[model samples]
Target: MTTPELGLPMAVPAQGLPAAVRIYEVGARDGLQNEKGTVPTEVKAEFIHRLADAGLTTIEATSFVHPKWVPQLADAEQLFPRVSELPVALPVLVPNERGLDRALALGARQVAVFASATESFAKANLNRTLDESLAMFEPVVNRAKTEGRHVRGYISMSFGDPWEGAVPIPQVVRVCRALLDMGCDELSLGDTIGVATAGHVRALLSALNEAGVPTHTLGVHFHDTYGQALANTLAALQHGITTVDASAGGLGGCPYAKSATGNLATEDLVWMLRGLGIDTGVDLDRLITTSVWMAEQLGRPSPSRTVRALSHKE
Candidate 1:
């Protein structure tokens, strides 16, 4: 029997898309945060190293939230120093002033603050009102900026929320604007529940632009719960968004939102981007190997479709 060929897709250049895309890899942090069993700190460090070796320039290393909130990432201090020598950008998620201070003390140059658009999510996830959460972030963002760190603000539920269905574009825009105004270098709009369609993605981008947020400063973080992540990403690309947040092997869901599912898989996003003739600078085979290894460590098969298909061929 003849062996089947495992090859890359034919490059079909898509118009109106950027020549290159910056994939903000989040597997180490967001991916492992929701795991039922704790992933060992050494293994998590190795995962980040493997991702950087696969050519992902921006990798979120870990979160500095309190151990009570996310016990999985309680080893942020230990993990950060282990992978700090990597040449890529290692952005850690900082929930507030305390988290930011922990990251800064460890020489982290890039940090991200996670925020919510709706009042319900703000209260549930942050134990504060939407405005109060923003107020809390104000000091964190300002301090990070004062220390010369590049801050990224992630606005969750930009599309829809389980408790608050169908988030208004204006509502999302307000949060985005607030973050940008607070000195965030970029904003990642997250569809936490994966309920956004292509049109919704475009409409929200348009609204942010109309509100004076530049397309260059926006990134899209879509969940594949309803299988709309890739579609929504294409819409964002068409609107001139160049930064995208994807998790390796499709790992991670919002711990606060039960309905939120895994993030858009890095491998899947790379496959589509490669087919579109867009550059992501990732070694697909290497990334697949990393995800497969991570899945082995977790004792489960990877949820990424591209990882499954390509790894099978290997």
Candidate 2:
């Protein structure tokens, strides 16, 4: 396997050494994006602030995509600036050059570009083919680099797609390499339809690593569709990945996945990590409070087993 030339330290420690992992909280964006009711701008900002207080260093704050697509985050202009000044590392999603323009105008220090492993899902989600979606991000990544902003590339449906069945491992590696070649600082592998298994994740990671994608440059975003997210995440951990994306209270869903659900709950992931004696620097109790608050605001019960168990004890 060709080693991924990680210009910086891999999020994981040197190979063969266990390292503490960092969790990227996406509740403020991915979570809220799927909510039936709208979350106010003030409320969004408050939620982000509370997440930061809970010791999450990286937060996926919002997206600058068309308001028509995600009405929940229509206030990108208002929300980006509000989050930029926070001490935490806040990265917003930019769908294209237009979204990048808005995020840059707001002095965004970091931004994300999304692509998909499946052509059908890519077309429906971004209205373009895999090549077109990646091509669209070229200018965004270049401009972001020129301005010294970090760029992250997201490959949705990394494991499986609702429309395309099981994704070919080689194709997944190709799209991931394209994103890396396009100058994205990192690549997030998304199980958008929540169909990933531990073996699937392990196989993909090994393939990507062999194909010259750095394991450290990889992050995992899994959904609990088959109740395999946390287990898959541990498989990634075994391969030396440290950045995992999760939403508080497990708040998200793929619009395309039939009977799909949200990302793994941050609190639940934390619970697992804590049991392993790995330090995440997160205050689980405070996270529970925040998750409960958001669930109340959304009028839905949290999907986190840890949250539910904790609530029962309380």
Which candidate number has the best lDDT? 1
- Model 1 agreement with the true structure over 3-49: per-residue lDDT tens digits: 32265777788778899999999999899999999899999999999
Instruction: Give the TM-score comparing model 2 with the true structure, all chains together.
Output: 0.93
* Pairs of residues clashing in candidate 1: none
Model 1 residue 160 lDDT score: 93
Model 2, span 184-300: residue lDDT tens: 999999999888999999999999999999898999999998899989988888888889999999998865555568889999898777655556889888888888887887777
Q: After superposition, how far is residue 57 of candidate 2 from its true place, in Å?
A: 0.5
What's the CA error at residue 191 for candidate 1, in Å?
0.3
Evaluate candidate 2 by giving its C-alpha RMSD to the native, one decimal: 6.6
lDDT values, one for every candidate: 0.94, 0.86
TM-score of each: 0.97, 0.93
For each of the candidates, give the backbone clash count.
0, 0
